[model samples]
Target: MIKPSSYCNEDDGEFKKEWKNDSNSSSVNSSTLSLHIAAYENSSNSDMASTADTEGLKGKHSLAKKWKNAKHPFFGSSSVIQNSFEFTRQQENDKVSQSEIMQFKASQKLLNPNSSVNHQPGEKNMCLFTLLRCSDLVMQKQRNPEKKKHLLVKKLAKEGYNDIYSNEPTKFIYLGNAGFVCGVSPTYLQELFGKLDGFHKLHSFRHKSYAFVEFKTVEDGKRAYELYDFPAIEAAPKAILPKGLSVISEFITPEYEEELLGFLNENNEDMKNRSVLHFGHKFDYDSNSAFQKGLDIPPILDELIKSMQPHFGTHFPDQITVNRYRPGQSIPMHVDTHSAFEEPIISLSLQSSINLDYTHCANPTVNTEISLPRRSLLIMKGESRYCWRHGIRPRASDVGEDGELVPREERYSITFRKIRTKPCECPYIEYCDWNRNGVTAIPSNNESARQVEKTYVQQVYEDIAEHFSQTRHSKWNAVANFLDSLSKGSVVLDAGCGNGKYLSTKTDKFFMGFDTCHNLLRVANTKGEVMNGSLFEIPIRDSVCDAVICIAVIHHFSTVERRKAAIAEITRVLTSGGKALITVWSIDQKTDGQMSAYAKMRSNKEPTEMKQENNAKLMIHDGTDFSHCDMLVPWQRSSDGAQFFRYYHLFYKDELDALVESFDELTVIDSAYEQGNFIVIFQKK
Candidate 1:
């Protein structure tokens, strides 16, 4: 039997042994490689998926007859599918092969003599009834076999299935192929599919309620589970099953559930005009689909997923969609009913924050809201994904109930689920009036359906995150390089300084600073206890200085001519032979380099009013087409206009090298992490 609790627990203890490096399930693409910063190694979120024994949940019923001898013993859920049914034992899977999985998954019926004779004799269903340990965690399995077993079930009338859905005593099977297959042990069935939701179909012996349905394709099987999850109308005539309820919800109507499937089906008016980044499908970070815990995934994130597996009964390692939303961006309403695991979807929010909106699928006007704080997790099972749709409302500013306007920003969301359809664009676009009359009726015929899906997809987003980065450190290399340029006791000068955060850290005692601003000097002096004069002119003995070290303070100079003059003065004050360590933004095409200084001119917001260091531009024309003036900020020398600067600089390698060599003999580090900037270890002669 598939016991989630047991599997989750096992994963918990084995994480140390397994989850140190759970690599991406596929090749590390660009997007995946970019977002991985090396600074978060110590942080751990203890909720990773592990083994748990959930067999004790309220009502206990006999499993499908084929799995009669199956007991709820679990090898684990995250790294492997741990259900056993002695089969033909072909050389199927060496290390949990898919061939072996297919062996048990394809078994369609129980020939056990103790079977209930209600089954239509000789009736065959191509279904696979293998009990999978419950979990929606990513990367739970250890092996990656090429081939495996498969399951099959008869396809019934969509309408007829709906009619008999609530009252029929459908036969559950452990079938494989044709008339040839292995029958599953019953206890195993109960452990996997939630203890049978006690509903019956027409002619079903009111005594044997609820049925477990498994499709040959794991993907198809999960979607079928969600669509036909027809909850039993308890008070109606076919109420032979245990009340349908999960740890997450009471009972919700099918109509209510469909309304919640907004993400799956988006045709609302308010959602039409939103300029969001993406619309559909599942995503997760892995080299492949193996859920082996200790492989590539960091330990901290693994635990957080483990804590929620028990509630996700059968499907192990749910297909998860990992998304990143920068400031001023969001995802519209959508349903997750198409997931491959038929199990519930669980979302874990990390880094930064956002306001999440949940609304009725049928009525977009009525909505529920929650401020998804950082480090929080939300789970939607049973009716949550089917009955109630969820989305993120775009907001430029968010005011708390406390009336304090808190600054809002970009964030990362880890949405976990089992994928149903292959990742693709939304097809219903062109003919539909989503942007026109808003969800107005569009013909629902097949040809139109194809076009509807085609035109609507603006684009399918592919994530390109970083794989790794340097760890954090406190000291600066520039400090050592600066001291190296000095003699036994020569006065060293720091110039063009915004502040003296670097004053006291210089190696020898000859360090002093010059700044264009004084308020900055006050803050710096307090931190370091010393201050010199301005950079325009120096009070020290001319030609008596040994060295200087300038940090990221050059790009902000009034202009290139003025910056050159500033560097000239530093040289004028230097001894006949001395050096300097200069670090400035140097542009590089190797990475997302700095924008041209002009991109800012086009982005400047016209100022309604201006403050001390901030300016409002006068680029607006007072005529026609618009009103109230779309505000704009000034064109600062450096800074990414929108996504917030990962690093700020408009440096081109050649441009920076010329600027430095223009004054003295300076050597720029050929490969600085910041392409827009570089470190120049200079020696003045």
Candidate 2:
């Protein structure tokens, strides 16, 4: 009889070697068990199947009868009898594989025959049972190689297999036949596949027309294979063009385009580079405005406008600006000044094709790129003309939808517009230059304030979080000193804690920060505990924080009531006598004899005047002194050249003190002007 202790040896090599040596003995005490072990040991040899058919047929019959009556060692006695009988029936029906049957029989023989039949199996017996099940799964996988391995791993996990084996790295081969073709660059492949989860690295063999992608886990590789191994159904391109904008391709025949280009060539003074000619009005490129009237439109262009009258309906363009761009010349991204031009603006492209990009004025995420072929007419009106900035990038070649580079040549465009006789009254009030300067009162109610904050503050921060984080690495000395003064083991909260710059100042204290922008919170999460929440309604319980800090956050509120409520919420979360530090942009940038850092950073060049009357919000010019108490500050992203505007309500002297003093439960402890901010420290009563 085989010794149970020998079967339970920790080293699997010794146990298997002992079993193999014992199988060759003719004097083995358990003859029936020896036959099963020998059969399993030689199962991989081709001749073993024939040997079992010839010399082992009677033995197999006798063994099946014994297996039906014997108890299974792995499963407990309550179910082993039923399980063993069912397994014997499966063998007689040929439902189980020959190798699987041998493996099961060999494992059963290793158990001590003299032990109690109802005793529980040991850990080694359980391991043997797991091996038998795993071998059965391997046989099933070979029969159907396309079976998803993740499902097999999940089944194994349910059967008590080690979880580490399920997470082993898996290699996936992406055949080039599906959508992607051979000889496609690896850079392009990485761009397409790198977005999937668990992607480690990819190796391309262009000559063999396939690539190998190694995933961090088997499940990840199986998911990627299911998604990319087969030809995918093409999806319709999303509609990104702004409303009221349309492009007419091949708007004019080749002959008509030549006629229009002939007049422009004749009128073009400087042919080697960029040249411009304005008619009906002299366009001041610097001011983006039409000034004194200039020459009349050429007779050929006037005739073309007359022919195009039906498309314009009642708004006939009275001004024309003809621009000729040499091989690499292009226009900067800009919205035609709202005060300068009327609706239904049109541009006719001639000579060569070029690309035009449009970005929404308020939301940079809503954008599109267009290619204007030669002889195409680009029409803009309503939101497209008033709310989207259009420009052409300076490049010798343009990237097409397929990512191929299309070389460029000389191009000419004739822009036609009518000088504005009145302020724009379109529906896009937030983006309209006229409306921004008009007598639109400050948001009076909570709903109106929420709308203003949502579009100008919250949305802008979410879009510029990455670029904004790069510029905010330096913490203010006053704020850092306040954090350093905190007691050890104190619970601190940073409201509107953008990028969590101050969270790591003193690791001794428990720091938790929250922000309204998820993008900023994602960055903050790596530094400390951070959550997505609003300043107006902090999620923490009342009187939970020993100290609170609100930095340059209350100024984003559009109205006095909202700002005061934000302050109240901060105090509500503070413990009794707990101190809170708050800061806001001050209207008075210059204090005492020194200019604040904001004013010092202003460019030497003159800024365009955007002052408005009647308490209207002004558009703050880039790198300039503030001219209004409330304004829209512009932030342009460096990556895509998209601009987003954030709203700010600057605080005047003693303004923050009065706002904090209105709450009966708070007391102002200290106030000062640091940098360009109005800093105030207060305590909850």
Candidate 3:
């Protein structure tokens, strides 16, 4: 009978001595490895057969029953089938040899049960369970000692037992209710838990609900199981699990975490389209299949993956995804397509910790939330990797087991996967990409609104973005010279920056640009940091930019206040000593001959009337007609029969200078006419 104790404090040396004596009873060769343990604690043969049948392992179970009458204590223990299962590597020769050793040991122990042996008064020693499923095949191989290994391999593959040949299994022990200790420092927990003899590595996942601790040996694991009784923390109520010595804790130094965080920050860039960069085979949404794109994985990433081989096995990841999330951002719930990638996906987190929600596709109500800590590596395999869908919720702060957990900074993650070479034969075919039978994709409402906004002004540029880019290839000499004069590493902002024409000018410094047109921004993205946004409202930190350039943009405003507002916005974003270059279309640039006809076309209303205010004249285009300062400029696409009109407020040289200087905080540095435009450089007070 097995004695269940509250604390089993046997030391490592005692266990080692017992194991050596037990192992001495048999000297088995690698050939007889495919042995099965046929005994159970309380289950009858019929009960075991029912279980095997339910699991679709009928053949394996029947083979094991054939050895039930064998007189070996090692072959009849309940632990053999439960705690003693060993994970075999995919290496073919080693797998066969190891399988044979299991059988040889079991046979030797059965034949010599009366040999001199030492046992803990009443405790049963457990033996590792071998490939019980391959017993029948091993018997045949034994009969014909000269049988080739290839034949056995072919038989095993045909029987659907190949999945067991997984990569070197990761050593992990799951901790229940880790969320109760979110306030506790990981380093403190690690130190407290490290007191247990064999604890080597420790990690905790999202919301601190659970954690995994690795040990050096099986004896250490059993010792932890018996001695470390988890106690409930102060945060948990009666409903929470009681904890005396919980199996949750581990240490990661602050210096190590900071190094990883710095790496991610250095590589991050503002993205306007997809939140992540997909490398290797790109998954096509339209066709619902993966296509091989000739992009190679970065060498640095390859080195990082290689460094993780000890923990995650020797699986080469072909697909890599890099994602950066700021505050109030999130990734929607979705599962990796079964047909697209292999099992055991790894995600490395950096900078900020976050909670991840996991749900079963078949039963959505049964959900699990895991907290991912900074600089931690998360491995998803087996049931967690295949059957569930995982995602992060959109929120600035997450409510943990105790209270809210607010990230002090941004978060980034790199997800790595090995693309499957062949068709997927996974059991969850119903939820796979091949059919999407049970899967439902939910479109983002926020993204839909953004798409609609893009159609207003963005679609116009999208129609002629490439052609317009061609006409403006050469940079304006004066603006180019000013940009070149700036010191290296000076932050620059391109307000209403389209196609990123001047982006490459600042090489050493960070250059950021924004536009309402997504199509134009896509082209600009190749040169610098460009995002989809509006000029009237800048999406950046206050007073952070060293300089700003708003060219051929202010003239597009319909009202004088709007134009003034645009200038004020630029001033607000500039540093104290920062300067800005503002330009508008010049009415003087047009020939006098065309002025009469244009005047007639715009003869509907009077020119803008204004009054002096705040030491400078207020430039108001209120009640102005469609002619004079306001006119619609037409553009024709050479590729198609489409024509579009753009609004423009032509500014005289004096008027352009006065409008900019009207802001009390701005001091005009220079004003001039250059390249059919009125340009003015001003500094913020």
Candidate 4:
């Protein structure tokens, strides 16, 4: 440390007077007293320069009187270093004159010699120890010390660094894949690291989870690396991944994932639209020859496209293939044909979390697996997309980041790609089959297409539970009033009580609800008892419920036989005199005008109409045959600048009544149209 030359003569006298008056000064060491004197001398000149009467005092009372009673800038009452800087504020709020100020100035001089220094108000004159002091506060929080310490222990344990408080300097640890689990707090880490010799500062990575324990000298890092390299207890999980593969944990929020799922569900039918090359012009795997007009990017997916602008740069993706996966379902191992799509393909996952297997196309033995969390966005480009044939194994569940085998839930992924019009211009020319030499591959059959549709029905609703729960907060007055009419102590059965929004209102009755989607049931179970069961085959026995209400569930069946079976099941569950209510979306609703307006906006024939409030119309679709009375309607959920969709079937007014009439065990009590739904009350005969 460098020594200072001089202090203001008047300041020394005042400091001495205050120091002698203090009773605690007797306990202070000689070194601390010397430091106080040095600090007062160095900062005295700067403080005196800022006074309002510097010139007046110098002319009248001379130098000694000018410095007397000017200000106790260094200390609050010239007692100790802690009371001055840490406890109380000095007269000059702008400048914090402390013992550390002398050392900071000396360090500055040593680093940059022969430099002129000026200490003024509102200037960047903060000492180096300011950060250290700030960090110390975290370790010594005033309130609820036990609770804070427990939280700190839990956080450190999650990162596999539970001994952080004890084994800090010896172990320079950084967290990986800290999606939900808390890690060592920044302030705590800083405080611990600041105690190390030759410590500079801590540096966090682009991803918030990762950080570096930086030191001023290379020797410190080497020593730390050697000591903590193979500790008895590992600090962080070992990441053994294939080359060019990465997992970004929690890339998107749960609410945002729900919105994306809702948007996709609403616009799912557009994937079958004529403009899309993949849908209209089928790929013949055998010949490897196909028209390259490319798939048309749907206008509904513009929000996702815009969100990906920062990554793709000038090249906007021209194709989006949304795939919904059910439990035990996985994609085959195959490279995205080089000529079909450009480099840097991105896939945004929503709903369920799963593991992806990446195997080298050339070297089949070289493969690795990466666990993907829900709402993670994966970017596959160059070697990862081309050289590797990435796929997922067929499994109902996968290991999570926490190392537990978690059961797989329904999942949806939106894969975005820039369609490559031309053929074969990659490093793996031998594997390039875009310009095929007469090699033929069989096309997918109709059964495969039906399987995909079946999966969509099961997976879409399951994946959007969290997001769908958010919107289902408002209970329909019509349904709530109907539940209110029921007598107290009546056992009520809600067939598809999503999130149990109405169950809360019927507290007087013992209400039990069930749905096919377990994820949705998870949300509903919080409010009331909910079971995982289908409408056609309810887990409950016959004549058990006092009343059964199957709301918006009858139309889900595509066939008349299945729809009739669902009605019979509900009737079977109710007593002879018990009342049952059923509701379904109606085709009688006049949404044709809105549908035409949406088609026009989608076609860009009338771009100005895009701003129109036709969200309901945009989602409804009428089947080609009105006689079948089977049409698909979509529900849109938008959140955080993204959208998702879920599909439902609407029933014609007469068709719903006819199905209910066919149930021989039930008699129609009342029928009415309320809130775009055909609601009918039936009494068990």
On TM-score, the leading prediction is 2
lDDT of 3 by residue, 1-685 (tens): 0011211112222322332343243542221221111211212234342222111122223312223222111122111121222212122222333355345434432212223333232122232222121233333445321121222222222221121221122223333223223333344335444545556655543332234455555456556543432221222221111111111112234675576456556654556533455667654543424566735776656556776565456668777777888776766566676677887777877677777777544334345666666766777776666656677866667644433335534777777788878877665432345433212111124443233234323566778887777766677876887788677878889998898988887677678899877778888999888887777798887899999998888887655666787888899999998989988877654332222222222321222112112111112222222235544354556678354444456786588788878999999998876645778988898
Candidate 4 lDDT score relative to the true structure: 0.50
**What is the per-residue lDDT of model 4 for residues 1-685, given as tens digits with 9 covering 90 to 100?**
0011111121223332332343134443321111100111112233322221211111112221111122222211111010011011123213323344444434432212223344232211111100000111222343221222222223322332212111112112232222111233444344344434444545432223334454434456435433322212212244366545555667766777777677666554433211112322344434333344535555556766787677676787766667777687777666776777776778877788888877654334345677777878788866787667777877767655544457987788777777677665776433455434312111133443233234435676776677778876665556777788889999999998877776667668999999888888888888888898888789999999999888777766545566677888888889878988888876544232122222222221111111212222212231111212332333344443122223345676666778878877778878887655788887888
Candidate 2 ranges with C-alpha deviation above 4 Å: 1-301, 304-315, 318-340, 343-416, 419-431, 434-441, 591-605, 617-622
lDDT of each: 0.35, 0.61, 0.52, 0.50
| lDDT for 297 (candidate 2) | 74
Q: lDDT score of model 1? A: 0.35
Better of 1 and 4 by lDDT: 4
The sequence of per-residue lDDT tens digits that candidate 1 reaches over residues 1-685 is 1332322231112321221122132332211111000000100112322221111111122221111111112211111111211111111112333364345435533233222223222222122222222222211342211011111111111101100111111122221111101122333333333222321111111111122232223344344333322222211121111112122222233443333333323422222333121213323222212232222322334554576667566544534444556576656565543323344667655555566655533223234555555655666654445534567645554433232334666565555555433422222221111233222123234443223222221010001011100111233544554465456666667774445555666455656776544445555565454454544455556677777666655543323664566566666777766666666653332234232222221221122111111112111111111111111111111223211111122355565557768864444433343322466665667
Q: What is the lDDT of residue 439 in candidate 1?
A: 24
Q: Which ten residues in a row have the lowest lDDT in candidate 4?
A: 125-134
Candidate numbers sorted by lDDT from highest down: 2, 3, 4, 1
lDDT of 3: 0.52
**Clashes in each model (backbone N, CA, C under 3 Å)?**
128, 0, 27, 15
TM-score of each: 0.31, 0.44, 0.30, 0.33
